[model samples]
Target: MSGGGFSRLPNGTVVVAVSLPSPLGDGSVARFLVHAANRARALTRLRNLGLRAVYLRGNAEPPTPDEITAVLHHPDGLLWRLQGAPAAELWHPFRSSSPLRNRWA
Candidate 1:
């Protein structure tokens, strides 16, 4: 388990941020942010997208306001990046296969 949590928008929507080990077994942790109507739906969205073991139990690494806006502005309302990677690194959209590869693995 990396870190994860949820943040709700004033409009009643939620942004869920979770950091998990890359499913690709690349030994790198990747953070996923999902914007949805509710926290449950947000996590479910990721599960449906192929992160089958997804879950949120504590508010350890909730999305910051800026991060929420980034996901909301994105076409798919979903974004991901390597854990602790430089802010200059681009956040990738949801892909069946991860985009992190082994750069930080």
Candidate 2:
């Protein structure tokens, strides 16, 4: 997770940037150069891990050394800079015996 290279997706394709919420609950985020077949699959990976993600516009291609360093050195992780319509903002509601799921189903 600490490397500058892209992470492989489930389908073995390559994407550029992915913004993942921190599992550590330290108010920090994790940014990855993601490898996915497409945007939906990339998002599915994060969603399965119970994470919300965004794609950074500038890093949507293979990141340069400076871009890698900049993301790593970012104070609040990379969530702050990810913007645009292509970004995925997924919300997983708390699991419970609530009737919402049944209604939707």
Candidate 3:
């Protein structure tokens, strides 16, 4: 298992930050606000984008008006760094042995 599983609710928005392996030897991290049914789905989507290192940040249930504003108005910027990896572990949400299997099914 990669980190903890989140509640299977589709009415929330999760903030995801991913670290892209750089070819220049300098890594970069980018943040995105994703709207999904749950954190598992969010992680899955991020993985589908071909990112190997992803992390889940804060989330809001039934996102508040302010939260929406923040996502739309002031998007997160990428951070350049020399080292360090994503904070969260990456796992398949639909693995047969995963607790989230039934939830996705």
Candidate 4:
């Protein structure tokens, strides 16, 4: 899933899909899949990383089973990309994504 909603795994964790406008103010949306113990924690993880605009919307795009697995196995429990980005685009860890940094410099 790429827009919103969450899925519970067999191990009792959750994978949440969140979409928000990029911090760069470029009219582009950033999508994220986060694996956490629950929904609040998932959002909190993003917020803690300076993504304050993110929130769970309706289940417009829930993470697919495969997408959940991808987030689950990620060490930091997060994967991100620009919405509508090419399929060949990479999903990056939040810390390294340009969207979170101020490009003004």
Going through the candidates in the order shown, the clash numbers are 0, 3, 1, 3
- Residue-by-residue lDDT tens digits, candidate 4, 1-105: 125898878889889988766667788887788999988999898778766666787777888886777787789888887888888887777764454544412
Order the candidate numbers by lDDT, best to worst: 1, 4, 2, 3
- The runs of at least 3 residues in candidate 3 whose Cα sits more than 4 Å from the true structure, single-residue gaps closed, are 1-28, 55-105
lDDT of 3: 0.37
Clashing pairs in 3: 10-37
State every prediction's TM-score relative to the real structure.
Answer: 0.84, 0.33, 0.35, 0.80
Model 3 weakest lDDT span, ten residues long: 75-84
Q: Which of 2 and 4 is ahead in TM-score?
A: 4
lDDT of 3 by residue, 1-105 (tens): 122122332345443333334444334322233445556666676556444455544432233343334443443311122224354533222234533223323
* lDDT tens readout by residue for model 2, 4-102: 234333565544455444454555544444334654665565454344334344433455554444444544222223223234542222223423222
Please estimate how well model 4 matches the true structure, expressed as its whole-model Cα lDDT.
0.77
Q: C-alpha displacement of 26 in model 3, angstroms? A: 4.9
Per-model lDDT: 0.82, 0.40, 0.37, 0.77
Give the range of the ten consecutive residues with the poorest summed lDDT in model 4: 96-105
Quote the RMSD, in angstroms, for model 1: 3.4
| Order of quality (TM-score) | 1, 4, 3, 2
Collision count of model 1: 0
